[model samples]
Target: MRLIYCCGVVLLLTLFSRVSHGGNILVFPVEGSHWVNMDVLLRALHSKGHNITIVRNSKSWYVEENSTYYHSITVPVERSLGKEVITHLISTVIDFERGALPVTSFFNMAVGMMGTFTEAHRIVSEFASAMFDDQEFLRKLKDSNFDLVLTDPCWGHGIILAKYLNLPLVYNVRWLIAGEAHFSLAPSPLSYIPITGTGNTDKMTFLQRVKNVVMYLIGQTQHHVVVTQTYQKLCEKYLGPNSDFNELSLSADLWLMRVDFVFEYPRPTMPNFVYIGGFQCTPAKALPQQLEDFVQSSGEHGVILMSMGSFVSALPADMTNEIAAAFAKLPQKVIWRHKGDRPANLGNNTLLVDWMPQNDLLGHPKMKLFVAHGGTNGVQEALYHGIPVVGIPLFIDQYDNLMRLKERGGAQILQINSVDKDNFLKAVEEVLNDPLYRMNMQRLSRLHRDQPMKPLDNALFWMEFVMRHKGAAHLRTESYRMPWYSYYSVDVGLFLFGVFLLVLTTVFILMRCLYRTMCKPKVKQE
Candidate 1:
């Protein structure tokens, strides 16, 4: 798995240049903000001539019922699970930010994730029941003879199904949370790799390190406990009575994570772990006619784009208006992704759309600043386009991403709770007026772009590599065999300590005997 720079390796990869895989690839995309990056990989794999069938909720299955490059298998859902997911997610953050939730110990981030798992468990149960209960659907699915299954590890349904279907499973995760962090697929050392959601960078202060370890331990524990409890039922009922979901998830063939050492601290990663950061980005395309005109009409001031990503498309109505008020005051024209009815006081400079081409807007020459909720896809997109940001981070990993950018001088994070007109306006103006933000972003953009290969090319290559090798099991880490105590050398340290104690005790006993013999010399002679 070691990457070779030789001509042979190049020739081997070149062999796949026109490789149109005839195999069927099935994908199960998890709910929420992951769609941006997931779509990129699925589309690329489909374009490479693999039959890609995305089993998505019927509501969000935008793909036609029939197609050549891509198709959809509908898993009927009752309602938009979006509202429940984000409502619970935002509520957790609100509790933490207000100090209503205790953080002095393990309950810190663990409690929040318990709620998240419940939401995931609920949604996945609905999806799984729909899939498994329908005998026709189940028979058709098992007959598909999929070569591989692409999935989000947020839910265990994919892993369980892949195992049932006798196909290799590859986990493509958008979030780098504790569950993936602790997986046997790679090494994510806690000392450097900040606990996801905790806003620490690679270099942390003493207090931050202490907090990092606590968060790390708790997060991993919570993920294991909750997921095991929730998914074990599904696995037993559907897959097998004694089958464990966690073990199945860990046994996946490979992992394609939306992470890179450039954005994150340099850490050890197993060969099977692929970094496809900026996979959401592509060559910029023309904006919609209306958006193009708005930017054109703005002339010199440029345009500012604000989107909270798909998850948080609509904040509370009042909060949305308060935000719009800030945009109204800006010299630049505004494009806001709105999910609800337009605000009454909408400014002439602002335009509300259900969706706009996010990447295209960032790549636009006149995109002045991006105000975002700091989702990985949007953050990476902004970094790739070299645009300064006014980050309003909403949740866990978003906080860390925004903090990373803020520390690097490419952005300023306005507090999510304390966001009012003045504070929001100040952060926006600072990023807009400051040359450093632009300069820092340009440097980061270069670093992000200057990799040995394009992110998409790398993603395609590694996934193809998995196929070429029939599985990337060769790249799986040996850490899987190492026990927790042995992996950290704690047992060895204790063994050495025991030996030292034994030697010291023996020497002390001998010395006491010698002292007693010498002191009783006269009596001993008698």
Candidate 2:
């Protein structure tokens, strides 16, 4: 009886210890796909006994007001990115890609995208303003005694909030308000690292490098103009005139990057940046009975899964008919996630659903190929499952995401404007018949799976590490604190150049004096 009592005491103590170690985390997340990944992280944290509080917009498109995992503090806002707005933007992009002239297309797309992004940032800034204006809400947040702020820096509200609360900051990030997170935190040489939308690989020729530089300048200009117009004023109003939005965005104590090197180019990263790519991926779960029945019906042919992601519900009707016709010719059974008018050419071999378990579907042994829009989440999931891809990238970073896989020989790219029954069929047939594509993707899967620790566990460890240490200041660099000239060593270069010129001038003067002295006539001295 005494031994039994002792075991019970130890068990109770262990449980209490785990419960006591739980940290209070405050999260500010972006909507759509970003929230999908962030929700996965929050669930993991919750499982490990952390208390999570999310700040959400009342008009959130994906984030729910109620969840078992975390409590939410919804901030009412007049404007948010709704499904209609995103759908319209995507449709406009497709039009630009298909109809506009080559040079005109590039310029038009840039201007249109910049305008859209600028407005989105403005709305987010207003949302932050709503939260700041609420004294009672601010008091509640202060009283919550949160250990850290976990946010997606794609929007700047969270960064400013962390500063306003004087809390340590952490990022679940890939893109910032301007561009790729690496450009802000790492050494991204244009000679190798391709900028988004350039469709160039790390190995670039002279012309590609020129395009890379031009794209870089354009990205920087967008960042400057948009940030100065929106986040800058918000920072000046709340964090004081001295605070800079760009610096605050880079001030996170830790960066939980959403990509791993397996899907990324070999580029320099920082100590605080942690790659948690495919962290959302897991072994396949059992499919629904209807879906399983459909898969089993395929016999030896296998399955092809197609999804265009959350933003694009449908394509143009003609394009849809072409894709449907291509699928009809394939021996494989097709499952497409589409929310549009049924294509007239859709075959009996294809099943169109409003939604499907994408991760689970990809992980299935029967999954032979993936037709995707190349969103980061979808691409990583495809890589995780070792399924080769037929990439029809829509807009923004989709092409760039697929280019990474194509460069590695795991995927094939098809232009949106040029996809038809013939080319679509050809691309699908090529990926399906070629054994090399599958082999390469499987190889990537092995590499991604061979990490020292599971990516999710690594992310959790770092998050808890910050909680225990109060911040990851040791891992973080002070480089963001430096001015641009100093950060790039441009000031040091100029100083060295000045010194070199000064030394050269002094030597010249000394040489002249020596010649004058040596060549003087002896009679002059006498």
Winning model by TM-score: 2
Over 1-526, each residue of candidate 1 has an lDDT whose tens digit, in order, gives 4555677778767656545445678888865566656777887887776778888777653334565667788877775356565666776665465443334313645564576566657676777777878888778888877778888877667877888887877878744223544334466666777877667888988888988887777777776676666677888988878776656777777777787766766777666777888877876899888788888998899999999887766766666777888888888999899888787667889988888999999999998899998888888989999999888876667778887788888999876667777788888999999989999999999898888888788877877776667777777765555667987899999999999999999999999999888889878789
lDDT of 1: 0.76
- Please report how far candidate 1 places residue 79 from its true position, in Å: 7.9
Task: Point out where model 1 deviates above 4 Å.
Answer: 1-20, 57-68, 75-113, 129-139, 176-185, 236-243, 495-523
lDDT of predicted model 2: 0.93
**Top candidate, metric lDDT:** 2
Predicted candidate 2 versus true structure: per-residue lDDT over 285-372, tens digit per residue: 9999999999989989999999999888789999999999999999999999989999999999999999899999999989999999
Which ten residues in a row are the worst by lDDT in model 1?
Answer: 97-106
